[model samples]
Target: MEFAGCSRGSSGRALALAICLLALISLSCAARLSASSRQKLDVHKHLNRLNKPAVKSIKSPDGDIIDCVHISQQPAFDHPYLKDHKIQMRPTYHPEGLFAENKVAESTKERVNTQLWHVNGRCPEDTIPVRRTKEDDILRASSMKHYGRKKQRTIPKSADPDLANESGHQHAIAYVNGDKYYGAKATINVWEPKIQQPNEFSLSQLWVLGGSFGEDLNSIEAGWQVSPDLYGDNNTRLFTYWTSDAYQATGCYNLLCSGFIQINNEIAMGASISPVSGVRGSQYDISILVWKDPKEGHWWMQFGNDYVLGYWPSYLFSYLADSASMVEWGGEVVNSEPDGQHTSTQMGSGRFPEEGFGKASYFRNIQVVDSSNNLKAPKGLGTFTEQPNCYDVRTGSNGDWGHYFYYGGPGKNSNCP
Candidate 1:
């Protein structure tokens, strides 16, 4: 009987231990599930904070992440509807349903009155006009809000060979006619050049303009850096631009990118372009646009050929109240150290050196459009049916628009006077 009792006691202890182990495991799983739920809720709350009702969470077909937003049809201050009259606002009967279709966030709607009427130069009858305004006041205001300024970086002449070209390699040219000032177009011929020192300088640059001596440079759209910044400032090449699928690399870098000016790394708006591991200089003849949106503290970079290069969002711009005094073009290095350990990108690499690595690229026709005319005409580079919007503002093909041409040396023809 004693032996039996002892055996029974041992069995009971083993069963109790097993039960405890199972209970611990179950409790651990529950805790994990609770944490996951909390994390998800936190993410949702943050997104809601953006207060953009137009945004919709979507799962990409390939399981990638993609979000969609509805374009608002309601006219803002600068739309054609508001061009002729002053705008005033009044509350609507059904505040919740007012912007239902447009999907503007609830928070945004609440901030401003539901019924707002925009006006032309004069104030609407009900509202008083402010002092010192013009017909183009709205446009000018928007431009200032969108395009601020650029940080300046004056490069020493001996920094990088490609960037420090003593022969005046770095340059910017634009049409000078007055009417063309708001909009201008010019045809430039790009010639391919044989690669010299094939690795150090790939003949690519960011175009800068302040009218050769002014204090502003236009941003390059869809720009990307590929080579690693190994020797620090010794390399001066930024590569690869494309407009479409068949339009591979620019064939050669001898055209507009013989040399480019370097300025402070301040960008009004910009994009990054990257080449794959095996691809080199396959696309060519590309155009880009940079614009600002005041409400959003971000600059935009657009890419395309005479036809189409999509717009990729880059959040690397700070708004400047003053105009950009300088524009930077090439990727010449001034130091031999790595550009700090840069963060990795899903798009591509920014470590490329102009002549050090593989093949690179070129750029041209750098121009600066003031806030007064940022949206009056397209930058003239994208794909537009009846001449580019840039050229649309032009009077015609010949001398109607002021023209600046950068022709490659020797056998190349610039197609300009």
Candidate 2:
């Protein structure tokens, strides 16, 4: 009888242990679900982010991990211009959505390629790009709210902790034509840079301006950069920025501002353009041309051949409203290296331009829009650098590339720092 009682006691203890194990497992699962529910990625309260069909998330050039969402209407700022046009959520020929209808048949034939966007300063579609302020997806960028603690400040935005909210673009640019600028064009290669700080990045791009480089500067900037400090991953992407008064209160990187508008979603400023880019020696570099319409007085930005993203309106700038005074093209790097050793942060490919073609990085066929709105090879080109040992430029003109140059060097070179 005693033996029988002991067996019953043992069984009771075993049952209690199992129940405890089950409870612990349930608690763990619930904790995971709760944490996931609290940590939502899309911080922009746009309605399109809710309960949408499962879409792939891509890394933005600046480093934010964003889920792709669709919009059928223009942002509130572009409402006036988009009133007459139907919104296009996907590219006509590209395939990424259930709504994407391929309109063109793929060609397998060999073909000759020519320049895109004849210097007429006309947008492919009749519509132009616009920007937004106060409330926009890109405004809440760095909504991961800055990864950790405070580190450094480049321009004293002591209160705004979000990297994007700060002076987002701290560039090391090369300039030409200080007062004779109309428009500028260049082809830039994209590369993923090593990012040490959330606010720092590396890229190759073009900056066209009209006013002085001081607080009154009016400019248009476009390029490709890898900013993990901003986006999340080091995915290189196309980017654009414009401001009537420097970068103070009027403009933003990509569509974060209220003046630039988008008609095609196939290739966007912040979206990953990786599938068709990044491979060297494959005729895959991005050709960007920003020219002003002498008649309409609008600045138009064009990408490659088929994609004309859109334009920034004339009334958007005080200085650029008339004409650009200067033009610039080259590589930029923001180094927030904490250990103080040069941030392995590369500007172009992290390789020296002396390495050449597939081995290094370069910009070819650099041109500018003349008064007649034609793409003309640059004349009397001159270059500038903040630090020659870390980054440099070499320009030349030829029958093939017209006027082009090779630039960029790894930060913290053996001879630099």
Candidate 3:
């Protein structure tokens, strides 16, 4: 009876093992059915994607039909502006980052070639070659529109026909005594200096024209006037500069601190003369300041010496922010007196809270640098600073005007030839 019981127990154990195996097989079959159903669903979803309008066709290397239609859920070129645009895929030559260090060479052929179009940045000839396509025109059109209507529309004659005929370039168009002209002018001053405040001064970061800039009430035609009646004072010397014309306001006084030259108003890469005590104004180069900005494709203001002061992006406006459309070359003073009475409202004056350090001065040369030519230096006014030229020519015995006398130097030795 004991042997029979043991044998029955072993048989029962075997039967339990077989049941477990069958149960595992059944679970596996159910899992495989679930996986199959999932795969079918995925295939159905892909088929539904084929009906989308965004995708046009899909081609295979072996010339076999893949999905040939849009299988993507998101539509390409769905934007309202790009509804009519089409999408295409083709092998393209993109910089692999490995060859980026190498300088690309320019092609001798002017016509578009496969090799030339595929070339990348900064070729040996210093030109970037791009694949010629309709995209180029599109890019140009987009850029032209970026400046808005002001930049796109042509100028309509609003003034007299004679005046409009006299007007040439819209930029750097200088007017001297209500006359348009281009040249360099310089001047020297001899007067009593005033005592300045301990720390009162202003600094202008000129990104445009440079070379002696300041307001001199004693002299007119060059100094910038904040008001029609107001002029720089000698008593407080609040709204005045001596070194360069540009300055920063420190309260009610004008600080004759130095200005900085920046490249495109972004990169600081050049030197500037800072305002100091008894810093006698001299021929400071404004050319570098103008050239720096021009390198970034913009023109800067030139100073009394016909040198660039610095570049200002907003100078492109026909109307200046101050409503002063013209750049004055000399100084404008109240009653043409150094100790003139200050009466005009202080529009743009400031003073140092601590002490007086700076005063206003004058500016002379005014010219624009032509940036179209990519030369390293400024194109106009070859000299960095122009010497004093005679403004008041005296008629000689020979009936010819002496140009040298007006320049403040000794008259020319040679008679008029």
Per-residue CA lDDT of candidate 2, range 201-263, in tens? 777788887766457777788877776544455666677877777555566567543466565
Worst 10 residues of 2 by lDDT: 96-105
- For all candidates in order, the CA lDDT equals 0.25, 0.56, 0.21
TM-score, candidate 2, is 0.65
lDDT of 3 at 121: 16
- Positional deviation of residue 128's Cα in model 3 after best superposition, in angstroms: 30
Superposed model 2: Cα runs more than 4 Å off: 1-72, 76-173, 275-283
Could you arrange the candidates by TM-score from highest to lowest?
2, 1, 3
Off by over 4 Å in 3: 1-192, 195-261, 264-297, 301-309, 315-325, 333-417
Q: Against the correct fold, how does model 1 do in TM-score?
A: 0.30
- Candidate 1 residue 356 Cα shift, in angstroms, is 11
Instruction: Output the worst ten-in-a-row residue range by lDDT, candidate 1.
Output: 383-392
Ranking by lDDT: 2, 1, 3
Q: Between candidates 2 and 3, name the one with more favorable TM-score.
A: 2
lDDT of 3 by residue, 1-417 (tens): 233223457677677667778889999999999987875565445334322332223222222121221211222222233344332121121112211211211121121111111122111211111111122222232232221111111111122223321112010111222221211222211111221221111111111222222221111112122221111222111121211112222101111111111111111111111211222332111111122232232223333222222322222222221122112222111111124322221111221112111222212222322223222111222111011120111111111111101111111112200
